[model samples]
Target: MGSAVLDIGGNTGALVVVTGPEWSGREIEISTKDQDPLARTRAAVRARHTGAGTRYTAVFPTLPAGPYVIWRTATEPAGTVVVAGASVTEIEWWQLP
Candidate 1:
């Protein structure tokens, strides 16, 4: 079962940051490529439980499809990803090497 809060469709998409308990209560930032580096959207990391187990994550429910940068800090970038319309983009931070 899923929820209806994610309104991804048309030229819009969604993003999910799959992190770990260590990142709980932290805010994760992201910005579309065309936006100023200083302008970013943020979401607080929360815990979600599924059949597998409980996991920490941040969900950006809706965003315009395009290249986006994941910020490590206000001035540092951790990585980048492309968001596709009508779908969800996920970043598994805990699994990063």
Candidate 2:
């Protein structure tokens, strides 16, 4: 499984998103003393799956600080649900069964 990273910067805070394989359509929010966006993104990705099935992995490093929504969309004609945020963090296309 391969991983990709995206960096986000805003008045709220810095954000990082990651994507790869074995990822479920899930979103995670982390609030900690540490303020490293990269670390946070990495931790978030690690918490998620590596890869599985047509569902590939994806990561969002940063998003507007506040309540947000993360949804899945088809990359192309294939039925792969791409986990996308308000802003694209990282996108990875995996092989289908």
**Candidates' C-alpha lDDT:** 0.86, 0.37
Sequence-dependent TM-score of model 1 = 0.90
TM-score of each: 0.90, 0.24
Residue 1 in candidate 2, Cα distance off native in Å: 4.8
Which of the numbered candidates is closest to the native, going by highest TM-score?
1
Off by over 4 Å in 2: 10-57, 71-97
* Residue range 1-97, candidate 1, lDDT tens digits: 2232798999999999888799888999999888998889998888887898887888999999999999887888888888999999888975433
User: Candidate 1: misplaced stretches above 4 Å?
Assistant: 1-4, 94-97
Question: What is candidate 1's local distance difference test score?
Answer: 0.86
Error of 2 at 7 (Å): 1.3
| Per-residue lDDT of candidate 2, residues 1-97 (tens digit) | 4354555444233333344534445443333223432233223444343445333333445544443323232211211223334454332334321
Weakest 10 consecutive residues of candidate 1 by summed lDDT: 1-10
**Model 1 Cα shift for residue 7 (angstroms):** 1.0
**Deviation from native of the Cα of residue 9 in model 1, angstroms:** 0.7
